[model samples]
Target: MNIVDIIIKKKNKQELSYDELSFAFNSYLKKNIPDYQMSALLMAITINGMTMKETINLTDVFIKSGEVYKFNKKVCDKHSTGGIGDTVTFIIAPIVAALKIPMAKMSGRGLGYTGGTIDKLESIPGYKVELSKEEFYNQFNKIGLVISSQTDKLVPLDKVIYSLRDITGTTESLPLIASSIMSKKIAAGATYIVIDIKYGTGAFIKTKEEANEFSEMLNKIANHFKRKIRTIITPMDNPLSSCIGNALEVIEAMEVLKGKKSPLKEVSLEVAAHIISMAKDISVKEAKELCEEVLNKKEAYKMFEKWIITQGGDLSKIKVSDKIITLKSSVSGTISSINALNCGKLAVKLGAGRLTKESQIDYGVGIKLLKREGSKVKKGDVLAELYVNDLDIKLTDEDLKLFTIK
Candidate 1:
């Protein structure tokens, strides 16, 4: 019953019952269990891992810790497990909505190297990231799409545990990660969910094997709850888009919505197609064709515009820093690679992302790729441009190492 026994039991690699899991978690939420005690249990769970039953129990505890939203209409939702230049939400939501599917998403903010959907949306002036429940419901009912920040009332337990996990180096635990993500999605009440699992240098899941394992775990949990779920594993060795900052990413998303063809658009369509298939009871191929039709006909873009206006986002006010530092090749060759992890780090250094929770984001600053992998480059050919407002932030040779040519 006590937290010490729970910590010891988990540290011994024993399975915890639902009551034990709930007791420890709820005690922590009530401040009866100190962080150090919780930290011990978390580390134990991370290293020893949790059984499926235990993980499901923990996820249920997380869900019960806060309010669970319900919608009168069936809605589809999408989530990505952190990545560089992963702006699929912007394009995917509108595409689904354009096809008359409802999508209500609760997005997060940038913490380390990855960009957040809410942060990108906020770059558009007057865009409201926090909405009351009534406002969120109204927007979903009106436009069939709404993306906003998670309210404090939803999954508050995950917030506490996630912050602890971040500092304790326990974030990579499969059970913790699955519970944290699934808790939010379940609480948000999406009837159908598509989780885009990214794996590579820029993503949390570093290898394809791990990505597959994680996806299986997700599907297992989804099945337990009887939720319709699809998990798509994608590579994140390079930026998903040519742009890697808040406002710049928003601009790139708009371009994709306007019928621009690129890898970003392809990924968006793939994810949207899955959601559409689930929501409309059609095949993914048919959903993809529908997505292409709406995107090509500018219906998705129009929906995007309408969603923005409904949420008070001003596209005209979206701007990137004009202070550009273009990185060019000193030798001619084909671009063998662009390190996504390094690109994300450089963007964070340029104030495009937050190092800490309290750190302010420089919405106008980011990186724009002029040339991608496999592109031919001559000496002095531009490889990328650093859009920055701070003149003091100078480019370094380390920054140049982001691109490899041979």
Candidate 2:
């Protein structure tokens, strides 16, 4: 039962049984297993990979490490693997809740290139993220919606393991990624989980093949645990929405709910449709139609305003940067492409994203895409706008690389 033996077995590409993996995690949490040894095993698992059983076992270990919430209705939890300008969660929660679906979501904050739902929500002044369990249940029961922080009691071991993975350079391991994500969802007590798997330069996964593989693994593991899961693989060739900052994204979400049509609306509707279809046992087509109806009638938007009020978020107090700069197109042709990753990096540079976990972000800072992929742009047409806290934030040639024209 020594941790070294488990490490060696995984390092040699051998499957560690449920007990072995469970003991390892429990021991790690108890401080019986040191990080260097655990890190070595994580790296080994990253390179050598894990079998389906091992992946499931690992997920089970994480799930058993914490408390699971119980609700009267089946909780419909939607999670995105995350990408630049990803503000789908805000729209989906209200839309589905407007249709009477119960959505109790526990969201994380932004870390690197991707923006998080909680971070976006917190951009609103006086918004409270840490809700009491009573508050969480009351909101869900009364309004059919609740989105809050993941408490220390829910999958607490994941914090330690994930932190180790963050610094050990082993975050890309498929099994680890799948188990890490699925474990949280499982522990959260969601009856149905919808996964938004984005792939491309702007996403965590880089290719369709890789995204598919990740989705398949997630599905397989979900089935093993007897939990239901659905995945939507979308292209992140461009940002999901025109807005890429905390406050900016919340503003964009509000605009979408108000019936302004954009790429964000299109993708958010699609994801919401899946959630409704799965939770209600209706066809995805019908679910999409319902989502649209809710948005078009302004029902979802009203729900959003109500949800914000209930959660103590003050929209009027959300700040927007006064120093604005517009980057216009130098030449005209249909926009050939918008490099998603570079665009994300540009937002990070503009003080919209964090360089480290502890880094502070200017909620008012972000980028707006005036000319998206395939849009017609004449010379001098405004391509994008940078909302920055500092006046000296300049766009470089590398920044221009985000916009490619024919």
Candidate 3:
């Protein structure tokens, strides 16, 4: 079968036969099918779109290209499309794990504005993010929560296809996104799955309506496949929590798991309670009580620390710098708005995040706002602090334009 014919066929809005799919996948894997042809095929798929059957079949094709984990033990996991300060995974997994619910989770790195799970975990000193299949499985069995980078062997084909999608501008295709997410979760041996679909200025979907649409699509697909999945649509109009960036997020998570209360703690606790409730087959109220117990007993944080240690991460020496470069209000008044998008941009500029994949992140560098939401301020009041290596880090006057006081 000619791969070019299949590409053109897809481009023409034709549904490919199973044999054609097999041939194309084999050709791609064998390096016989070039990227340009794949790009054409992806663009076609993006526009014409795939039927649910086609999407699932594409998933099946990718699944066959690598190994899938089998826990035999009951396992559960969750994922977010990503949002500012969305550290739910770091909080929820441990809660469920403390409840003795098995959590087999894999995370990724930051691509753009959204933070990466692996990046947050790496903030802990000596924590290992890369785990082999045996290591991941063993860690899951031992700790009940194993968080690591997606294994190269687990859904290798998805990686290749995903890269193609990224460059081809086909990353936002709903079916492709759903298949990519669900396939990875399904492969990770999660008998139960909870999806946090976020939308707002900080979310990729950019609107609650769009985020909910993706949530529904994922839920429907998971149900049709008889894979139990719970999807929750959340708003990211503001930072999911106050903290944004890797190490600071870890620090913030430490506080949440330690039973501290903040906007972040509130959101994370709510999510953790819900997911833990569902994963353990308990009522929401009971799930909440359990999370409280985990936090009160400090088991959640301890489990987190344990997970870090198990992953070869050192916890003791890991610290976000206490020495901060505070940006004070030159003139204080009624604070009108904190533009999350621009603050995120400024944070990235100040080394709190990455502009590209290869960019180095300062684990110690981050942004900490002295104020959040509504606040009355005065001249000389600190608005935020830029935690960085540069002694003379400047908060550009342009960033000040985004922070307004009326």
Better of 1 and 3 by TM-score: 1
Q: For model 2, how does the per-residue alpha-carbon lDDT over 192-266 read when each residue is reduced to its tens digit?
A: 999999989888788999999999999998898788999999999888898889999999889889988888898
Cα TM-score of candidate 2 = 0.92
Regions of model 1 farther than 4 Å from truth: 1-5, 31-40, 164-168, 394-396
Error of 3 at 377 (Å): 2.4
Candidate topping TM-score: 1
95 Cα displacement, candidate 3 (Å): 1.2
How close is every model to the real structure, measured as TM-score?
0.94, 0.92, 0.87
The true-versus-predicted C-alpha distance at residue 188 of model 3, in Å, is 0.8
Q: Mind giving the per-residue lDDT tens digits that candidate 3 earns over 310-399?
A: 888886777776667777887878777766666667667767667643577777777777777678899999887777777676666786
Question: Per-candidate RMSD vs. true structure?
Answer: 2.0, 2.2, 3.1
The runs of at least 3 residues in candidate 2 whose Cα sits more than 4 Å from the true structure, single-residue gaps closed, are 1-9, 27-39, 163-168
Question: How do the candidates rank by TM-score, highest first?
Answer: 1, 2, 3
Candidate 2 lDDT score at position 315: 88
Of the two candidates 1 and 2, the one with more favorable lDDT, higher being better, is 1
